[model samples]
Target: MGVALRDIIADCKETLDLDALKGVAAIDAHNALYQFLSIIRQPDGTPLMNAEGQVTSHLTGILFRTANFVEKGIKPVYIFDGTPPTFKQETLDQRREVRTRAGNAWKEALAVGDIAEAYKQASASARVDAYVIETAQELLGLLGIPWVQAPSEGEAQAAHMAGKGSVQFAVSQDYDSLLFGSPVLVRNLTVSGRRRVRGRTITVSPERIVLANLLDYLGVSREELIEIALLTGTDYHPGVRGVGAKTALKLVRNGEFESTVAEKLPDFDPASIREFFLAPPVTDDYNLSWSAPDTDGVVAMLSGRFDFSPERVEGALEKLSVKAKQQTLDQWF
Candidate 1:
């Protein structure tokens, strides 16, 4: 999970039409793949799988969603996460426990004919395994979409690309990108459409968060913001008990951050966490390049290998080709 700063940062977000977004974006590949595996499932909680029982939901998502991005004039560069920091082991372990519980719950729900609960728990149990990553990378390569392997967290690398002006923004569903120093962060890019929540259907649109505007609005420095997250919670550390986003914000603004941390979290020091977010490991060795998709290769992999419908594969390729032609014509003028 990301840092729990949404409550304090809600006012900083702005909704935008898909047409308004254009330029290169650094996408968190793991985050997006998880979304795909979670949301692109059948009503019975089963993922889209091939004859050999291989999941294809992620492949379908990357192919169609990347085409949709190209249609909207957005060039995406996916960033895959590397080895996580040692401090995050606790969080990873907790996630594993949660997934195990959810998986058992999903099976129980299905056995009891509770489709809704099964679907919900299956969504929570979604995991991005090595097979998913390898297949996703292969599909991206066939589609001619560039990907970067980060030295640490994918969000940090995406933030670095955005901060360095290599990309217009970072795309993730987590607020941690802001903590990672991404100048601009776009959320809901992968799942931006009609979605069912609770018992109602609602429209989900892409939203943008600008770091400078957020800092100016909050009247706090970026370091202070990280302090707020530390008091609340983050992937690296469990925050102070009973501290929330608003409470943490108040503590930081009142200049009582140190006093509160010392009183509540006597055994924990936040300095290392602060330094990690501020100066996280990142690499500049990646090349961002977009090229025409390998049409025969894409068809062969998706249709022949994975058993996707040839017609749908061609339809997605057609969208990519049309967008490419439009861009070419616009440039020639």
Candidate 2:
């Protein structure tokens, strides 16, 4: 449940390209992998698998997409989530239930030969298993792409990096990063293509949201923004029974948030959740560096273990190498 600020926020612009990023990006790794698993499925709703029957969509997504980023002079630092806050357990359990239902729905739709419905449900049912995560880590390591394991949510860590000026932007499809104080957030970095709406599919571009611009335009402080999010709902808590984005904003603006929350969520502690968003767990025990791809390591996993074409693996790595060299040369100058 990302912050539902889309209805109220107007500082977003969808005119960004890879070349515009020309700086470091802190990516929400788990989010990106989940997107890959959801979108890279075949027409019949089956994921691409290796000879041993393991999913390879995540690997393929990371390889080609990250290479494109690198080739365009954008340095990406993938951030993986660690432990989750106890408050988010409910949200995770609900997601599991949705996935289970989606899985059944996907099978039923497929059985009935409803191809479109099957594809939609299959996308909803996609899960990033341990194998996918581990293989992705191995591949990122082999490609010499720097990654950080967050103490909690990857979005928090990515936001921290951006806020601290360690990266150019905090990259994710969620608007929650704004609550985490990321100076800038980029959405659709991975899925920058056509998106389906109610009935028609429309081509979409990458968009950027600036924290300062949003706050200034909304006439609310960052702290107040958190209050609005708490009132509307978040992954950690199920906001007030009847509150919504518009009403939440009104309450925040009128300084009635505390009174409203007290009446609606008498037994719940909204302050703590707000504080958690204001400052989530993050770490600084990682370095941001782009080195030559570990050719042997990449070969071992993609070719030896996963049976990916050796030529394809080498070709992708070669692109990374060329960009790494170009980055180094630019730095020297």
Candidate 3:
């Protein structure tokens, strides 16, 4: 569970374009790859796979998607997750259980010819396995995309990068980055597609979330915001029973947080969680640079090793190289 601040927090959104970004975006790698795995599935619920039965949906997303951004002058710095904090183990277990259930549901739906339900469950069951991640990293490397291995959560690391002025924004779909104190968060950076929401398809655009504006609108300190998130449940901990965003906001506003937490969450130590968010483990040992894709390396990895269509790969790379050269010429002139 990410922070349920969506309902209560006011967002400072702007329609994003490639020209508006001032610096590189620190992308949460797993978040993006998982999204790719979740969406690039066939109608029959099977993922895009190569001849060797390796999933290539993540690769397809990375290649074409990053190429699109690069052509339009938006630079991305992909950040990968490291060892998770122990507190998140339970949440990870819960997610695994959910994926298992979704897998079974997908099979059942496929058996019954419920194609829509099968697709939905298949998307829900999508996982970023070791091979998928390793391949993604390798592809990013060959493409000359900068990627960092974070000390912990990728979002946290991205947030840290933004805070340190290393990047302009942290890119993710979750609100936890705000708690990590990222000044900016960009959501829906990957696509402009229709989503099935409550049985209807809805179009979505990229939205920005500015931390300072949100805090000022709510008239709460960053710590108070964290308190509200704790009350509203997060990936690291289950919130108190019967508490939600509204009630949590009220508690924070009324300065009754300690009392209410003591009464309803006797075993919970909010401070520790607060500390975890405030100073999540991250690193500054990485370089931030964008370069032309290593064409030979990219072709060897995707076509020779993964069996992706060499023509398609070359076409996308050709466009990327052309645009990159144009941008370089424009910069110099």
Cα error of candidate 2 at position 176, Å = 1.1
- Each model's lDDT comes to 0.91, 0.85, 0.86
lDDT of 1 by residue, 86-140 (tens): 9999999999999999999999999999999999999999999999999999999
**Off by more than 4 A, model 3:** 191-201, 329-333
Give the RMSD in angstroms, all C-alphas superposed, for model 3: 2.2
Better of 1 and 2 by lDDT: 1
Looking at candidate 1, the ten consecutive residues that score lowest on lDDT are: 324-333
Clash totals, every prediction: 0, 0, 0
- Candidate 3 lDDT over 169-219, as tens digits, reads 998888899999999998877544467675688877777888998888889
User: Which residue pairs overlap in candidate 2's backbone?
Assistant: none
Residue 63 accuracy (lDDT) in model 3: 96
Assess every candidate by TM-score.
Answer: 0.97, 0.94, 0.94
Q: Is candidate 1 or 3 superior in lDDT? A: 1
Note the residue pairs that clash in candidate 3: none
Q: Which ranking of candidates, highest lDDT first?
A: 1, 3, 2
Candidate 3, run of 10 with poorest lDDT = 324-333
Q: Is candidate 2 or candidate 3 better by lDDT?
A: 3
lDDT for each residue of candidate 2 in 205-281, tens digit (9 for 90 to 100):
78888899888888899999999999988899989877887789999999999898788888887767888999898
